[model samples]
Target: MAKTAKKIGSSAERLLKVTEALCAEHGLESVSMRDIAKAAGVSPSVIYHHYESRIDLLMAVFRQRFGMLLALRAPLVAELEAQAVPDVDKFLYSIMAPIAFMRSKGEDGAMASRFIARALMSSLPEIKAEVDAGIRGMRETVDIAQRAFPHLSREEICWRLHFTFGVEHMTHWDNERLEIMSDGLCNARSVEESITRAVAFAKAAFLAP
Candidate 1:
């Protein structure tokens, strides 16, 4: 019994480490339980003992990242409600505020942002459901839209959200391309510029008749 329990504990730690490494090297979709087990130096069955399926494991991966983002967004809630700053642009800045901060936090945080951006772009239903559940304000913006722009319908409101999201996802790019494209040329390297462009474009597009 003692030996078996020790083995289980060891397997759990390995699984966690493997999960982190996978996130760092590749996003959630590219990993497999067998790959995780090999990275952890444990047998493949060990992962099954802990997770029912690979999707569950991937959920665990993005769940942690989602949690991190949510926590980062929490503080802005009060400001959001206060309407301290006029217009939806402030709200957009608040929502993306945390993600921009991740830029200076080194590779792990940066990669998390990239991985998350990629996941949202994919066609996987699991990913879509998880994102819907994870990013509450993503859809909550509908309320703001309705209140701010009564001329728009429920369907039009949804379109604005999609447009906003599409602009955000456009930031996900190849680092190689970025370096080549912007080495000496003008490009928005700072997070502030990217956010400004996205927020401005979204507001203009949504507010336009």
Candidate 2:
């Protein structure tokens, strides 16, 4: 029974891995179940056995990626909370570091970043809802923000978080835009440097009245 469970789990993971790679290569809207099944070297029926539909598979991929990211950030959040003075800098770093780490991970990370960005801001109602449901990390970040800036209302903290999201999205997704705008002077290719600048910018925005 344990061996059988392990085999099932392995197949499920392969499906997700193939789906992630395809989604990263081709935008989410374009990747089909047949595409994933073919990539995973499995029959479409087999894929269906594991996931009910395309959306289910996509949601599973997003949840797994975000779950990993949230796990990485949770400890940082706790450490910040334990601090005598809530260091907003450290708070921002804790929130942004997981994303930076994801961005540093090559193609799979890029796909996760793009999916997350779209999930947060997508216009498609069904897709947006599923993606939003997978966003525990964002809520956790909000909790930390509220704790860090107790004087600020939730609404205010969320607005500031919006700006921080913009910074992070740009750093991860459209990293080269800065280079184009700055005429090649400000290099945004280095993930560490990009996060440093973004944290600085976002940290100020959060502290702003």
Candidate 3:
């Protein structure tokens, strides 16, 4: 019984991994069950045995990956909630640091980071909701920020958050566009430097009239 259960768990994990890779490469709409089975070294029936459909498998991947993302940011949120005086700089730093670190890693980190970037920026209504629902840390950050600056209206906080996401996407995702526009003076490869500048910029925007 134990061995059978172990095998089941392992296969399920492998299936998810294969699905993630395929989706990362070809995207969710283009990937099929056969594609996943071919990559996982399993039959289509095996995939069905574990997941009801492609959507189910994708949901599993989002839930697992985004759950890890939230866990990574949870300590920051906890520290903020515990503070007698909420510090916006610290809150912004806490949120930006882990994500910047994730971008610094090699291929696996790049893939996960891109996955999250796409999810957050996706225009598709269903995909947007799925991504938003899983990122509890993002919602928490907004609440914490509101408490820290109660004078600001919710609209003001949300507008600032829009710019914050833009900063994170550009800094963390690393593209040549920024460098090109700046005549190679602006480099985004330094995680610590990126977070430092990002927090400062966001702090200014939040405090701006």
Candidate 4:
């Protein structure tokens, strides 16, 4: 019984690692059960024993990424809730700390961002809810800014709030694009620098009118 239990646990872990590896390499569409099992050094039967279908495995990858993303940014939430960076601009970037964490890392960043983009395009309702809720938090940040500076109209505040998230989300590719655009002339700069420039530019754009 002990040996059997240990084997089962190990198989589960290997299955998970294999799914993650496939996602890292080719995103969801390219990964199949046979491919995952082969890369994991297990049989397709083993994957089936653990998961119902490829969709199940796909959902698992989405869940795992979503959980890690939340875990990465949880500290930032605590800091802001504790009022660490009260300035709206810093606060804006601070909210996207998880993406910055990904950018600071290498393949981990690429995998995370691509997985997120794919998940965004996925039709799974639960995953959609998670993504939507995560995005909706940007509105809360705008509300915070409004509380801090109450002179702006509600529409102005809401639009600026949504714009901040758009800026941050779009900047996820800044490093990837910089590499291509600069032809290796410019190295990957700091996420902070990007955040600073984005937030400053956004503030100018929003507050100017």
TM-score, every prediction: 0.74, 0.83, 0.85, 0.75
Shift of residue 194 alpha carbon in model 4, Å: 3.0
- The Cα local distance difference test for each model comes to 0.68, 0.79, 0.78, 0.69
lDDT of 4 at 124: 61
* Ranking 2 against 3 by TM-score, winner: 3
Stretches of candidate 3 exceeding 4 Å from the true structure: 121-126, 135-137, 174-176, 179-185
- By lDDT: ranked, best first: 2, 3, 4, 1
The predicted structure with the larger TM-score, 2 or 4, is 2
Summarize candidate 2's per-residue lDDT along 1-209 as a digit string, tens digits: 99999999999998988887777666667789888888988899999898999988988887788777777778888898687557888888876687778767886776676666655564556667766675543686777778789999999888888888777778877877889999999878787888798899998787777
Question: What lDDT tens digits, residue by residue, belong to model 4 across residues 1-209?
Answer: 99999998888766776677676557666778888878888788888887888888777777777788778777665565566335655566565556777766787666666677667765666657767886676566666666645678878877776776677666665566776888976554567666666767777755666
> What's model 1's TM-score?
0.74
Candidate 4 stretches with Cα past 4 Å from truth are 1-7, 123-126, 136-139
Query: In model 1, how large is the Cα lDDT of residue 168?
Result: 62
lDDT of 2 at 13: 93
How far does residue 77 in candidate 2 sit from its true spot (Å)? Answer: 0.9
Q: Give the number of the best model, judged by TM-score.
A: 3
Query: In terms of TM-score, how similar is model 2 to the real structure?
Result: 0.83
Q: Residue 65 of model 2: what lDDT?
A: 81
Who is ahead in lDDT, 1 or 3? 3
Q: Alpha-carbon error at 103 in model 2, in Å?
A: 2.0
lDDT value, residue 22 of candidate 1: 75
For candidate 4, the TM-score is: 0.75
